[model samples]
Target chain A: MNSHDPVSDCPHIAQFGEAALVLDAPGAMDLGAQQRIWALDAALKEQPGIVETGLGMANLLVSFDPDLWQAEALADWLHDAWVRLPPLAIEGRVWEFPVIYGGERGPDLPFVATHAGVTLEEAARMHAARDYIIFAPSVTPGFGYLYGVDPALVLPRKKVPVMVPEPGTVSIGGVQATIGMTPGPSGWYTLGYTTRFRHPFDPHAEPPLQVAVGDRIRFVIEKVLPC
Target chain B: MDNLALSMGNALLGNPDHAAGIEVQTFPMRLTTTQPHLVAVTGAASAFLDGTPLPPCWVMRLEPGQDLVLKRPTTGARSYITVAGGIDVPLVLGSRASDLRNGLGGHEGRDLRDGDLLPVGPAPHSTGAQDFGAQPPDETLAFTSASDFLDIRVVPGPEHGVFTAAAQAAFWQDDWLVSTMADRMGMRLSGEKLTLAQPTELRSGGILPGVVQVPPSGDPLIQLRDANSAGGYPRLGVVIQADMWRAGQARPGTRIRFHRVTTAQAIAARNEQRDLVAALRRDVARYAELPGFTR
Candidate 1:
C-alpha cells in the first residue's frame, strides 16, 4: 500500500474555538483511524506555527498561534500534510508486567466474572491471554488506554466511580483497559494489580513512564509463593 | 493577553534577566530575590514587595534580597508575575509552561514549593531598572469575581445536538456553580442535572481547553489548560477563548452563566483581546522613553 495515499477515508476537520483545529476520523476507536490520527499528529508537529498537538482515540487537535498562522492557513496546511504523511509506524517498546490477580489485589474480579458469565479463574486467564496495545494516555498522567481486551470482558462503566486507593491496579471500562498510576476515582472494574508500573510524573526521571502510545504490553500472572 | 502585556511591560522597565512570567495561584507565596531586578505583577491585586504594598498590573523594581510576597488575591484567582527576561527553566516539549501531570517544564515540572531555588535568564546589555509604570486597561484584564456571577460566552460544539431540549435550555438558563473539583485540568460545574434525550455513547475525541463536557452524571465539566488532550463525553459547547480568562479567575462556589455566541462573534472577541494587548505594548514602550525613567 502507498504510504502517501491521502488515507482514502477523508476525515472531517473543524475549527475548534479560535486557536485549535480538530480532525475527526470516520470511525470511533478504530485502530486504523487511531493510526491515521497519529500520522496526522506526527506530520503537524513538523509544520511551522503549530504550538501543540493533542491526540484522541481517533482525532487530533492542532493548536496554533493565531498571530503566527490563521485558521484557514492551518486547515490548508493540514490537507497538504495529510496527503504527504507516511505510513504510521510507531516504533514502541514492549513491556512485561507481573500482576497479582483476584483476591486482595482485585476485589472486582468476581463481579467482572459474573458480568461476563464466566468463572472468576477463567476470566483472569482470558484477561492475561492477550497482549494489549497502548492506545493513548487518558484522564491522568501515566494512565494508558490499553486496547485488545477479550470481548467477553467488556463491561459498562460504573454509574458512580469508586475511589481506587491502590496504585498499579489494572481495570477495565467498556472495551478499554487501564493501569491506575495514582489513587483516584475510576469507573472501571479492577481486575488485578502490578507493582512494576511506575508513576509517569517524576521530574528527576527521564521519559517519565515505561509505556508510550503504541507500545505493546503483556501482563503475566505472578506465581504464588508458598509460605 | 494579560501575560503578554506584563511580559512586555517588564521588558520596557529594563531588566531582561528575570523570569518573564510568574504563576501565582490563590495561596500566598514568597520569593526572596538574590539581586535587584525589575518586575511586574498582573491579574490579581494582592501582592507586596518587602512588606510595602505593591500595585497590581504595574512595573516595580525590587532591591537585592527583597522578599516578594503574594497574598490571597482580592480580585482574581491567578496572578501573573513577570520579571525582565522570563522564568529560567529548561524547556520541555518546547514550552516554558510547567506540565504538572507529566512532571515536565518550569522549575522541576511542579508547583513552586518553599525553598525551591530557580535560575534566571541573562538580561540584555541595555537592561536596567527604570521608573516606568504602565498598566493594562481594566476592560482588557477580564478578571471575574466570585461574588458577581460570571457570564461566559460559548460556541456550539460538534455534539451540541445530542443534548435533550430541556438539557439544552437548562445549560443556558440555569446558574451553574463552580464545584470544588475546579483546577488546571478542568472545572466541574454543579447545577440542574442536564440529561440527554437518550444515552449517547461517544467515541473519545480531541478536546480543547474550553470544551464543555457532559458526563453520565449530567454535571458539566469545562476543560482547562491541563485537561487531557481527548475525552469521550458529549460536548455541548465550548467557551470562547476570549472569556476563558473569566473561567480561570472564578474560584470554587462561583456562579457561572453560559451565553451562546456565533462563530463570528467568538472570532471578533478574540481579535478584540489581541488588540488590547497590542495597545498595552505600545503604551509601555512610550512610557519607557520618558526623561524621568531611571534605574
Candidate 2:
C-alpha cells in the first residue's frame, strides 16, 4: 500500500536475538515504510555474513553470522544504515499479473464482494484500478501479501479458513492480497488465480524468486492467458 | 553399503545447527574410516563402537576401521554426531545445517548413506570439551523405544495481544504434544485451540526463528529452523534462541510447557547462547596457526 500514512508508525530497530535484529515500527502497512525497509535490506544483502533477512509488517529482521562479527558490531551497522540511508525512492513497477477469479478458482470472491457491499464486477474493477505494490511474501512461499485494498472492498477475512489452497492461487486475506506459491491451507480471500509465481524450492535458479519485497504488481484479467 | 542405520519411520537428528552427517535411522551402520577421528553422538537413541557402548551427546576418538553403531536411545527420538574439529562438510549458504524443506544445501542434497566417504572439515581451536573426562550419559536419554519427549519453555510473542485473554490462559494451562509430522520446518503441536480477539486481517507478519503461531485450524505450529520468511497467524510465544538448540532435539509425543518472559530475559538468554558458541569458537581459533592455516 503506497499511501503516505500507514495504519502503523515508524518502527525502531531492536535486537531479535544475539545475532539478529528486528527493525520494527508499530504502524500499519505504508508504501514509504515498506520501501525504506527494502532499500536497507537490499544494501545489507551485498554485505558479507548476513544469515537471512525476515521482512514483516512494521519490521524487517536482519539475521547474521556472529562468528565473523560481534553482536555489538552488527547492531551498530544496522543502526547506522537505518539512520544514514542515501534517499532511495520507491520505483513503482507496473505488472499485469493474470488472474481467473470466482468459481472453484476463487470461491471466496463472491462472498468477499457481498460482505464489502460491492458488485462482483465492481470488486474486480476496483481491484484492478490502482497500481498495487507487492509488499512481502506471506506464510506460503509464493504468496505475495499486497497492500492498498480498495476502501470499498476492505473487510476482515474468514474467521476459519481452508487449511490448504493450490499453488498459484491468488488470495486476499483481510485487506492484503497475496498469491499462494505452494499447496497448503490458507485463510486469505480467494480472489483469483495465476501462474506467474515460482515454486518455493528451486535449487539452481538465481534470484530463484519471481518477486521481491518492494516490487509493484497489477492484475491482468483472465482469458488473456490460458491455463 | 554393508549395513546402514535405517529408519523404521522418519529419523530426526539434532546436530548443532543440524549439520551434514550420516542419518543412521535404521541400525547396523558400518563406518569404515581411513584415519582415527574424534566424534560424538546425540539424540533419541543409543550408539556403540565395535560392540562397545558408545557415548551420545559427547565426543569420542575413532580409529580407522572402527565400527560405530547407533542403537536407538531409550527416551529420545533423534541423536546427533559432533565430530571433534567438527565434521568437515562444506557450508552452503553460510550454514553447515541442512535445508530439509528444499533439500538443496547439505551433503549433495541428500542424507548420509552406505559407501559415502564424508568429508570432515578442519578442527576449530578449542579446549577439547570433547575430552569431557566423561560425556553426558547418552543412555540417559534413551530410556524407551518411543523415547521422544521433552517439556519446552516459551516467551510470549511480539504479537501476543492479538489473541484473547482466555486463549492466552488456555495456552499456558494446556498440554501440547509434538506431532510425529515435525521436521526442520516446524514442530506441529496439538493442544487447546487458541482463539483470536480481533480476527482482523493482517499483513504477512515478521517471524523469528522458533516463534509459535496459531493458525485458523486453532493448532499452534512452532516455527523452526526452515520456517517461512513471514506469517500472519497470532503468535503465542517465541522459543529463546539458546533454548532453540534444545528444541531441535524434541521428539514426537513429547509434552511441552510454555512460559512467558520479558524481552530483557529473552535477550539475556540469547546472549548466554552466544557466549557458549563464542567459547567453542575460541577453542577452534587456537588452531589458526596450525599447518593447515599457516600460509
Candidate 3:
C-alpha cells in the first residue's frame, strides 16, 4: 500500500488536544506515501493561526490557536487540504552513507543479523544495497526514521531501549532504520555512522537542517578514522 | 530583575504562545524597564509584583524606568504571566515555543537564568470583551491518580478482527489501570491480555499520536506528543483531541475504558469546543498586566 493508506479498515480518528486534529496515516512509510502526506502537511501550514505543523511517519497533527477560530472551520480547511495534496515525485536522488559495520562500532550488528537469520556480511550487504528514505527527524530532534529495510533484514526491537545510543549511531530494527541525532540509547541495530548532516541555526545564515523528507540514503562501508 | 527565571517561566506556560505571564518561580526578579511594558498571568496560578500579590492573567502597564517584581505562586503546579504584547523571542522551526524535551527553541535551548533581559514585542490582537463566565473553564477532568481513567474509550482497529471478538470485547469492557510506565513517549496500561487471533509481524507502518497499539503483551500502549513517528504493533484507535489534556495531566492510577465513536460524533465534539473558545470574552488586560501604559 502507499504511504497514507493502511490495511487497517478503522484507523483511529481523534483530536491531539483542545486545538489540534490528528489524522492517522497508519501503515504509510514508503517514499511515495510520505510525499502525499507531506504535501498535505505543507499545505496545512497555510491555514491562518496554525501554530505549527508536525509530520509523523503515519499521520499529520495540526494544532492552531483555539482562541482565534472555530474548530469546525479549521477541520474543514484541513479536510480540503487532504483532498488537494499532490502526488510526490519518487525520483528523489539517493545518498550513499559511509558506515563502519559490526564489531565495537555497531554494538547491535551481531544481534540484528542473528535475529534476521543472516550473517554480518549478509546484513551489511543487504543494508547497503537497498535505498532507505528518511521520513522525519521529529522522533528525537535529529534522530531520523529511515524506511525500506530489506524485508529479510527486519527484526523486532530490543525489549529495553538504551537511554543514550551515542551520537551518530546507525542501526536498523524490524522495518525501520535510525541514525542517532545526539547520544541517545536505541533498540535498533547500530551499524555505522556519519556527520554529513548540514544543521545550522545561525539566524543570519539559513535554517537548522539541509535535508528534507524525500531524500534517500545508501550505506557505503568505510574504515573508521580517529580524531 | 531575574531575567533568566522570568523568561523560563514564560516559555513553559501552556505551549508558549498563550498570552500568559510568568510567576517568577524563584525570586529576587528585579526589572527596571526603560519604557512601559504590558503583562498578564495564565494557567491556574497566581503572581505578585514587588512582594505584593498581583492579579493573575490580566494586562498592566509598566512605567518607564520602573522596577517591577514578579512573586512566586503559593499553590498550583505552574503559574503564567502575560505581557500584552508577547515576548519577542526568535521563532525556531514554526513556533516561538520551547521544546525542553529535544532542547530546541527559546533562549539557548535551556532554562532561562538570572540577568537574561528581554525585549518586548507588540501585543497579540485584542479580542475585545463579551461575556464573563465568572470563572475560567476547568480541565479538572484530567487524570490525576490511577483510578480516574475508568471510562477510557477505545474503538476497533483495522486489524480489529485480528483479535478474537471476545478479546476485542474485553478490551472495551474491562477496566484498564495506568501502568507505572508512563511518559511523553507513551503510557503502558495494565489490563487483560489483548491477545490477537493470530500472531503476525506486521510491516513497520505509520502509527499516529494517541493511537492505541497492542503488542504481544496484550496490554495497550497509548502514544503521546513525543511518540515515535512509526511503530510495529497492532493499533486499536485514536484518542479524541479534546481528551489529550486529560492524558497530559494524567499522573498515575488513571483507570481507563475503551469507547468507540463515529467519525461524525468526534467531529461534532471538536466543533463544540471551538464554539466555546470563540465565545470567550476577556480584555487584553484580563489575561496580561501591561505595565506603564498612560493612554
- Measured against the true two-chain complex, the DockQ scores of the candidates, in the order shown, are 0.44, 0.36, 0.22
| Candidate 3 per-residue C-alpha lDDT over B138-242 given as tens digits, one digit per residue, 9 for 90 to 100 | 432222223334344333454666887888888778877888897666789887888877876654444556678887778888886556765667766676554
| Candidate 3 CAPRI classification by DockQ | incorrect
- Each model's TM-score for chain A is 0.85, 0.76, 0.80
List candidate 3 segments past 4 Å from native: A1-87, A114-119, A135-138, A141-143, A195-207, A224-227, B1-37, B46-76, B123-134, B139-239, B246-272, B282-295
Instruction: Evaluate candidate 2 by giving its C-alpha RMSD to the native, one decimal.
Output: 7.4
Least accurate 10 contiguous residues by lDDT in model 1 chain B: B1-10
**Model 3 reaches what TM-score against the true structure?**
0.66
Cα miss at B264, model 1 (Å)?
3.2
For model 1, the docking class works out as: acceptable
Better of 1 and 2 by TM-score: 1
Interface RMSD of predicted model 2: 3.6
Query: Which digits, one per residue and each the tens of the lDDT, describe model 3 over residues A1-227?
Result: 53244334223345443455656554545665567667767776676788766666656656677667556777666665555567555555666667777766676667767867877777787888887887765455453667889888777777777764456667877677877766665666677665454331233334555555767877776643221
Give the CAPRI rating of model 2: acceptable
Error of 3 at B90 (Å): 1.3
Q: Candidate 3: TM of chain A?
A: 0.80
